[model samples]
Target: MKRCLDEAVLQAYLDGELSGDAALETQAHLAACSQCAAALNAAEGEGAFLAAAFAPDDSVNVPTVQLRARIDAAVARLDAQPETNARPSGGWNFGALLASFTSLLTFTPQRAAGFAGMLSCVVLAALFFSIQKPSPAPNSPAQEEHMAFVTQPPAQPKDGSANVEVKDAPTAPTPEINRSGVPIQVAKFNRPHASKPRVKAAPVASSLAAPVASKAQPLPGEKDYEQAIASLSTAISHGGDAVLKPQVRAQYERNLAVLDKAIEETRLVARRNPKDKDAVDFLMSAYQSKIELLTTVADQAQVAALGR
Candidate 1:
């Protein structure tokens, strides 16, 4: 029989990873061996010490009432802020904020005062501009021309001769001056045309017809559907080509061709009769079907890569 058990064998025995026979033998050895028993005691004591030292701190745990109060305060602050400023729920980091605040306090009062004065000056200038009545801007070249039309001087007598009888010009398409001093070209709608228009815009049939039942209850999680399709399409377009076997690639191409044909036909129907709700629904369904197929192909490629 061996005089002593190896340290590694004793460790395996403690961990219960040894065979049943080895475990029994180790048990018998520990019974007779004083040094081995002492080593085991020491190992257990070290483990207990480590577990107690590194365990979670109960003091750091926030109370439910305090946490709720903090969350309510955050929500109130977010509501008070402008829409452009973000109000994320899980974005707080108290440690980082404390560090930033400490750094800010390190600045001298004089430096801070200089910045504050500059800000005050800016606010005063803004208030002055807002309250003061702005002087009228000089007339532009276009405005000057428009003013001439409105303020035409009366015909003067040439030395002794009476002023020539000035008749009004023909009422043709000419630019007229508006109150804003901008020249507006008065468009003549009554143009003597030889023939009517060759092609006219199609009238909305749905607008003319009576209202049908509102079948357009919003699609739940429509944003999720769009996001998933976009992510799958991007993944497939980039690295998926490298993972695809030749046979799988050929199959995907054939399926895609079929989907493309269906999409084209449905889109044509939708374009022809935009007022037809059924046609629009068919078109959208076809697009979604195509996106689903693309996602499946990309997922298959991803699984193959993982297996490899």
Candidate 2:
């Protein structure tokens, strides 16, 4: 008896479908060949996994009569096809048709349920994003009016300074009066007292002034958030008990949360590119957050114990 096993024979042995001499020969080959034995073992393991993963539920079993009826219907459909082809059709080649049908089978009720679940998840995600996203507020007439007012230039102040202009007020009308039966006209302009020569009021200095300090501008690429996070983490790790204040603890906790989120984002990037520096930077930040948390907690506990 030949001790060598062909692929089909090996498969049959794995399935326990072989019988008589062939089965005995396959068994002998499996016993003698470590490679064949390992292959068989692997095949059994895979089959067991599939069986457990895809086993039909007892609650959803098909009736024997229904199964038979389906088999009969399929047979009838096959018989109805013409035995000979009159000419080649452009619809689809046999292999392509089979592939398409196989693909369609992949979308069976179970698979279709899975696809529906996935679609529902996507829709829910989109809805959540839409709800969470910030949107532009609708323009209102009041808001428009307010905007117009805001956009208008400020009224110029009255002063004799370079940036200011002073305007004189209109003089009041003088009234005519009769005194001692004689009519007299009163002048509105008063002549300056000869004794005090008018020192033209030194042009009133401007009370309203422009800000002397200009706004500060950020430097180009000077501050990196990733490097900042990493530095924060290093500080937490090294500082240990030095950062024990409540305010410092709160700030550290907040930064830790940010670092955690950043690290998660970096991990997603790392999935695409293992060598991404951003991912590495985020990882370092995450490490720092952990260390900081531990150190802060330890310090806080020590402080509490000392008070007791």
Best by TM-score: 1
| TM-score list, all predictions | 0.25, 0.21
Model 2 scores a TM of: 0.21
lDDT of 2 by residue, 1-308 (tens): 44555667777887779888878877778888888888888888988988887777644766999889999999999999997654366664687678888998776788899989999999999999999999988653335435644675554434533442344455666666676666566767754543523334432233112211111221223135445546655554554645467787678678767756755544444433445565556555665565556555665656665665
Report the number of clashing residue pairs per model.
Answer: 0, 0
**Residue 91 in candidate 2, Cα distance off native in Å:** 42
Instruction: Provide C-alpha RMSD values for all models, in order.
Output: 36.8, 27.7
Q: Worst ten-residue run, lDDT, model 1? A: 209-218
lDDT of 2: 0.61
Q: Which digits, one per residue and each the tens of the lDDT, describe model 1 over residues 140-224?
A: 3335434644575443433544424444444578789999999998886554545532333333344323222222222334345
